[model samples]
Target: MSTRRTLLAGSTAALGLAAGAAHAAPSVTAPQPAAAPGGRPPNLVVVLADDLGYGELGAYGQKLIATPRLDGFPAEGLQFTDAYSTAAVCAPSRGSLLTGLHAGHATVRANPSSGARVP
Candidate 1:
């Protein structure tokens, strides 16, 4: 209905599709190095919901919003209670995340969703 809900729904659907595809698709990308006693490396799933508070999910402590799927992550996987971000906005923060550089050292200090090189 609303813009926020629409965006969230779309993002949620994309996430589900990506997860399903990763599991169903054949391994035709790369020859990953074997891990000790483990064939492949562990998969890391990062969900960055813009403007979502830490307590918004049921995993945390939100009574209003029912997030059963997300709540299960703590038991099945990892749940980070605290996290640090270089930027408050998504684009800049994600830029720093992918580059592993703090906001001060990163070139994309602002939201540049165009994926264009900044000079």
Candidate 2:
């Protein structure tokens, strides 16, 4: 299997987060809603920027921009000190988000202006 496929398969099984199993939208009627009595997996929101630098946000060293949302989020939640993208450019950066693959394994590396299709 390709590296991207391998990474995705490994991550899904390790995390116990199944894929392709039809799930209802969040509602009270859903079966076994939310985690059990014990602590459950925290919601994950993976935000990726195409070319945004580490110092691009107000929380970072960007002095001019006023990013209230980004700055205030750390107060409510944890802020990671070291975060990086899968690639330095756009296309591969997006591929990582879709397939959960690393930059080295991304087939759609570089700018990829040739219109790539997602599986």
Clashes of 1: 0
Q: How would you encode candidate 1's per-residue C-alpha lDDT over 63-94 as one tens digit per residue?
A: 99898888898868778888777788877777
Number of the predicted model whose lDDT against the real structure is largest: 1
For candidate 2, lDDT tens digit of each residue in 14-119? 4453332345444423223257457674465666656777787777678998878777767677676886677777777787878777777767777746666544
The segments of candidate 2 whose C-alpha lies over 4 angstroms from its true place after superposition are 1-41, 113-119
lDDT of 1 at 35: 71
Residue-level error in angstroms, candidate 2, position 82: 0.8
Model 1 Cα RMSD, 1 decimal:
12.7
Off by over 4 Å in 1: 1-40, 111-119
Please give the TM-score that candidate 1 achieves against the real structure.
0.54
